[model samples]
Target: MIAKKILNDTFLIRNAKVEDAIQMEYVQSRCYPTLHESEILDRNHFANHIKVFPEGQIVVEKDGIIVASASSFRCDFPEHDSTFLEETDNLWITNVQIPNGDWMYGIDMGVLPEYRGLGLSKEMYKARNEVCAALGLKGQIIAGMTIGYGKVKDQMTIEEYCKKVMNNEIIDPTITPQRSAGFRWIRPLYNYINDPESGFGSILMYKPVDENYYL
Candidate 1:
């Protein structure tokens, strides 16, 4: 399905197509360089995502250039896993996606450097939330990396850092904006990703679908 257009038609958000794999790869590389090479999705991975769950992937474009994207999939909460980290090994979309699952697992999102300030990330999430409501999914979940925490890790613990970001006392390049978009911190996830600032940990977050939320 096509997502609602934003920026007065200056930009558009739509479901990912197999043709977008190359641009998606470029954006993923530019956005998360710290991640190990094995964790980055390749062109075939993108095709598989579109093949298995088309509505779960959303992309933004402006002047025919892809600028940002959000990729996700449906999965049930793994009750046996202690931390969300256990459920994210290798960060492969195929390993976790379950077609009949109740929750929407947010895999990753990115916005190219030049397009950072236009609120594209927020718009893409709005589109994702709509998909959740339409699919009758419970809510969106993420293992959110605290990319900014690397700077202050020596001064605080990961839990403390998340609280500060949520309280608005600090701004995490990633977590803070996610909170603004409606996700709330549920717990700390150890070894969630390879990001150094977060000490390889991240915050497990959730945002229940608000049926009344509108663009």
Candidate 2:
């Protein structure tokens, strides 16, 4: 377990266990209220993820309460765009993960509303990066939610909004944080998930393990 104390509270970040499934599900539901029920991870899915790739699932707890979690798998970077369900194989992950894949595919990451500003997610990201380094994977890739887009979606195109976010003209609750965490935008994906708030759009982003990783 990775333990730290912040603001007089203790936080623990560690690889998830089967027993943590229920709390993980709870955290997921709380973090993604805008997502459709089918798109959110459930207790059974969390259990399956840990069973399939024990080291790829992680969770954060504060004062003994689960507050955040992330799920990931190994895969080769794809050449074509795909929906979130297709990329994650309907969240089963077993069929899509490549044991010897070149990249770490970040399936999802979430921090409860009350824990959002505490940098718990950042610690989780660090833990995942350590996993990538240990496995010799090239880096991490993900389809990030354009969460703030939902508020102004009818006023502009998804592409235009993404561009604005990219250029710092706008700050997306999701994409902006991802950029701060070192992800580079590749493009926008449509019909990525059932998130009306994001206008059903997601951003394809990548973070190389190192500057020389591609070389």
The best candidate in terms of lDDT: 2
For residues 140-211, what per-residue lDDT tens digits would candidate 2 score against the true structure? 888999989988988998889988988999999888988898888888898898988998889988888785
lDDT of 1 by residue, 112-172 (tens): 9988988998898778878888998878888888888889988998778777876789988
Candidate 1 to truth, TM: 0.89
Clashes of each: 1, 0
Off by over 4 Å in 2: 1-9
**Structural similarity to truth (TM-score) of each candidate:** 0.89, 0.94
Worst-scoring 10-residue span by lDDT in model 1? 80-89
C-alpha lDDT of residue 19 in model 2: 96
lDDT of each: 0.79, 0.86
